[model samples]
Target: MYRLKQMNTLRNQIFLGFMLVMLIVLGCVGFFTYGQVSVLLRNNAEKHIQQTAVQAAGKLDVLLRQVDTFTAQVATSATIQRLMAQEAEGEKTTFAERQSMLQEIRKHEAYTTGIRSLELYTTDYRMLFPLTDVSLNSRVPQEWINEADAGMGRLVWLGLDPRNPDVVIAIRNVRLIDHSFSYAGYLMVQVEKNYFEFSVEGESADNGSGEMMGLFDGAGKLVTSDFPEGADVEGMLHSGAKTIELNGSTYMPIQKRSEATGWRIIILTPVNYAAEGISVLRTVVVVSVIIGGGLFLVMTFILSTMITRPILNLIKVMRGAKLGTLKPISVPSSAMEINELNNTYNQMVDSLNELIEVVYQKEIVQSRTELKALQAQINPHFLFNTLEAFYWALEEKGEEELAEIVVAMSGLFRYVIAKTDGDEWVTVGDELDHAERYLKIMDMRMVDRLSWSIEADEECRGAPVPKLLVQPLVENAILHGVEQRLGRGTVLLRATPSDRPGYTRIEVTDNGPGMDDEKLLALRCSLEKGLNSRSEGGNGVGLANVQKRLMLYVPGGEGLTVHSSEGQGTTVSFEIPNAHKGEVES
Candidate 1:
């Protein structure tokens, strides 16, 4: 209150104080909001990742069980037992015996691949191996075998078959014959790791790196792993237990799997994917900060405007004077205070002019000014010169069609030189005609090496667009493209009306040497940017400028676009909100 009294006479100081307090308050709120949102985001993401990983693990569990079930079914099959007996009861057969038995097992494959090799070992402690002797190096998984020795019997998961990586996951079954309860030779089917990886990865895009979907033996021996080469799987994840870890680096993982195989199917996803809702909260807070900041400015500006309406008007005039907006004393409005400022601005301009005149000679200045003036006239004069030549050709060859062409040419020149009379928009027909004439001029200049076709719905011909809408692009297509190549080029102009959202479209296509997407993009950026750069190739590349002008005059006027590919043709199109005949004037 005391400071307010001290700065009472300083209105801007008071307003600044208000704005500063608002900024600090708004900033504090925004900061706290960001924190809360970020925490929520993290929590939600972690939770979601955990859930998904669990589900994926469950699916993988089913796959492992299916493979196990199939492997058991194949081994117990009467045919496989008979094949094993054929080799077992015979005199020591050659390597062919095991291969033949293995082939017999393969013949009865389920959805899962059958065992690559079958083993036959007798209770007498003597062994019968397949042609490939698949049982040569096959050892019962120590944990399961130990349990089997300890009478911990049933079907159990063996970690993997090291001899063949294909059999990364396998099962061991101990059955007693004649009440002896002896260990039987194990039958292992190779499961393709990549096939499962591709299947799961296809569904869950980001599950690659952190997700470990592989099987380990019941004894917890490392068997098959999808973890990147050196990731310590045995220690990180163990059978019968699942854990979630998100260090907030790249991804957060939610793990799910079957304890049966010690086989893990983990869905490791980016924490963000899990925490999408939390991100939304953060977004809301950020949006709120922006909205609050905006509201603060709005309130402050409104308060200031109400309190200092008269003074702000004075300041506007004062600033305008310095900016030369009041040069030669031009403030046409009739407010008393405004008039007074206008007078003061005129006096300042007069004072400046008197001072400049005292310092420079007229001739040196006039020559420099004239050079710039002439340079400005060069492009327009050259363009007009081309138009004039085209007009004469039309008069000589197409006299009946010359009137509309002449009128469009006149309108084009008039819009350029005398811009005030040009409305914000003109009819589509006029714009199309202007494009035709521009293309015609190019064709005449290039010995008619190009052909053009104009297509538009009759109703859309009256759709309004900013003046000189299609002229520059059509000119560029011919000057830079059609004429650049010697072959006869086709320029197709099409207008389409859409009823779905009630929009009209204009498309210009060219069959000249179409540019690559990069060059086309560059041209588009140049068109949208409207930077007044002369064409580097001397082909009058001013498509950017015309599109920019269209956007300026027509609200929501995103009405120019180009599509092209090398060796293919090019098409440029734009959409307008409305197109009604008789609704627009040229």
Candidate 2:
């Protein structure tokens, strides 16, 4: 009896612990699952509603466009053109005469076939034609007629027609080629309101059951609904045209809009159908756990619980470790089985982290060495020799020649040393000054063989560029490319400021021997793949460096382009933003 009482106490403790855990876990899982599903459905439904509204609005805009196009065609017709031409010739039209003329035009097959009704109003904003008496009561408010006259080239909605009560679209326009030929009149087209209502009705709304669709305006007015026509719409109408709600009993209310007509379409479905599987998913999670608990304990027999518990811990630890998350693993141990498992895990984690740290340090050192090697490739030795030659010439010359040589040397050395200071982009003036220096050196070598021009819209001069960017191309042209040709060769640089609204453009053109088609193709390929060693070692090293530097600061690196043809000439151009334009700073 004493042993049985002790066992009962142990059993009660285990039962209480399991009940507390189940309550906490179920709360997290059930609420999380409900929240996620609700959010997804709500977001999807709103997007669909907005898209539907946009499509309907677009269709309405198209109808308006159609009205504008037809009005334009009639306004330019030979008959109407001739009538306007006569009015310019000083022929006065009488009321009876104007009435007869308008009636004749209205009866014509072309006008009668396409238009529901037509009106021609005067410059003073008075109705002048289509008079009921053919001689009286045709005059209308001058302001209304003048409003139509002002709307030429555009379709203006004019509410309902006073006579026939149809929707009217109107335009007021006068065309004149020379000084004298001008006419004032408004063209109006009456459209049936039912036509618009019927077009929207084409959308299929019913989705089985007793469900239906509806439409409302922004003012909470029920325009047309799939529900019974005369029924009160207070329950269905919403102030804003876009919201979804559950209707009384079995319905899922989904609302959308026709932006063109400013009409809303709401659809409803039975809620019973949607909720059917929700309960089942909830039950499966809770009931399956309750039923399997006894069988699970029996099969495990104290072994599976011990093993599974540690595996779960290992899973938690590795997930954090892989993400470089600094969290330690801690799990309970009932006996030596779990205690040994915990010790083994900690050793493996420590060893793995140490190896990773060692590899990372080695990579950092190697990367620094490669960067230094790239810098050493562009030597200052080439510029020094050219500057020495220029100094001797300047010592024996006048102020003009001395000024020329000084400018040349300054430009050359600026570009040579520019690579070390950190900024990628320099002012346009700085780049152009660098180009002038490069040109001066080549000018000495080629004497009268080469000529160049740099013309930029004064507004464009403040644009930016990669440092030393313009010099390498000038070198490539004078050395391996264009300046080597025998004929009189020329290079031109031009820049235009963007009143074009997005980017700045600079262009450089050369009239020396341009690359054949094959060379241009190879250049494009090499650039995309980061250039080959043989290519980069040549002019490619400088070009690739220019390319890399530009990509860091400018969005589109490949925007640098060459336009050239075999036996013709080449134009290499690039564009970057002008920081002074107030678009981007630095």
Q: Say which candidate scores most in lDDT.
A: 1
Tell me the TM-score of model 2: 0.38
Which lDDT values do the candidates have, in the order given?
Answer: 0.61, 0.58
Please give, for residues 78-183, the per-residue lDDT of candidate 1 as tens digits: 6545544443445454565555655555565534543344444543323444433333234544454444344333445555565556565444443434335344
RMSD of each: 19.3, 21.8
Question: How many pairs of residues in model 1 come into backbone collision?
Answer: 9
Q: Kindly report which residue stretches of model 2 are placed more than 4 angstroms away from their true locations once superposed.
A: 1-282, 289-407, 418-421, 479-481, 515-522, 525-537, 540-545, 556-558, 580-586
* Tens digit of per-residue lDDT, candidate 2, span 1-586: 9986865643344554565565556656766776676566556644544454455556556655665566666655655555554554556566666656564555453532335655654443344456543211243344545555565434555444445544444544546445343555555566544434423334424332344555454444554445655644446444432323443454555655544344455555445433445566667666756655554445444554444556566566567666765444665666676667767667666776787898999899999999998777556656665666676667667556665766677667756664544455677777777787778767767788878887777767777776677766666555545555777788877777754565577777777777888988887666565553233236434555555555666754355577778777777677777663222224
- For candidate 1, the 10 contiguous residues with the lowest summed lDDT are 129-138
